[model samples]
Target: MSGTALQQVELVVRTIAQTAVDNEKYFGDLDAVVGDGDFGYSLARGFEKVLEGWDDIDRTDVGAFLKKIGMIVTSRIGGTSGPIWGTAFMKAGISAGPANELSGEQVVAMLRAATDGIKARGQSDVGDKTLLDALVPMTDAIERELASGADHAAVLAVAATTARTAAEATSELVARRGRASYTGERSRGSVDAGAMGVAVIVERISHAWTTEGAS
Candidate 1:
């Protein structure tokens, strides 16, 4: 039952798409508490397009699929999330290229590119109470795991745990950037909406990748 990397990527896409759809209301609710209530809907629409365009996406190579997905997200989705997320995926796609299969090192490289891209686009650091709060540490953990010669699943596991921890830690920090910044003290004790979404995607993708590798 072992699936290829492409299969893993596809499963991740589908799982993220499903999660975005199911939790759209939750994100909107979170956003409404502090910022604009658009993150959930915007993410849902972006991932929905990814799912609906799967037929065309399936025919493309991995890098091409990722690139197309990024473009689709940027063009179809609204709000700051669209550009930031699109930049992350596009950077990953560039790093991944059109390889038929990716080594663990390549996976690590892609993750690093994604993190750097998010930082570059958002100009925020790990404590910004944004998605970077999850992504930055996760990518660092992933690189460390891979450098230790861990398997892809192992690296992903480390990344997932790091992301979850970072996402949770966002609750304690004041929002230093984005719409949440205006809330100041009010933003404390609540997870950033975008960071929560990143955690969800990271956890799901880690589970899928590990299960696929084991199978």
Candidate 2:
């Protein structure tokens, strides 16, 4: 937590890429339930590129690094996952601007910007039975915890819990966006793969924050 914002962002992005790579099959299996089954594949491939080119990534600032990642995800990844996730990093990068460090409120703002980009790119919202179902709630939880003056570690833990709970709850909701929506009421019994993926990724992020030295 004493390092520059660049260090924090690097840790998070690396954790996310590793998580996606590690859970490729699991994520694909989850997506196969109602989706075209490419969610995991697309995500893993994209993040893999991120890791593969880690040393080449821009390190001038957090914004530049994130924007570079956004470009890679959008161009390298396939399927809907590419554009949506790409837009998130792009928006977050723009929101972050040229900062070397970000406060808790600034972090929340960056997340909000990313989510907003996701909503626009995917044409979806919180109740759409998409990743937004988990992402929005997790962001909200972080905002609330920050308002209460929680530390970074505590905020991450709360965010992980909130994402998992929201993702699981999506099982009870009918899909309203993406390929899953075509399933109609039948999608109710299964959780949104994207949402659950978010939960899983967030959980890994939370764990890494505690044990990874965060530098």
The prediction achieving the highest TM-score against the true structure is 2
lDDT of 1 by residue, 1-215 (tens): 15777777667667777788778999889777778789899988888888788777743667887777788888778888889889887888888888768887887788788878888888987888898888778878877887898776777778788888888888898898888899888989989988888788778788776565564
lDDT of 2 by residue, 26-115 (tens): 999998998889998999999999999999999999999999999999998898889999999999999999999899889999999999
Clash-forming residue pairs, model 1: 2-215
Candidates' lDDT values, in order?
A: 0.81, 0.92
In candidate 1, position 213 carries an lDDT of: 55
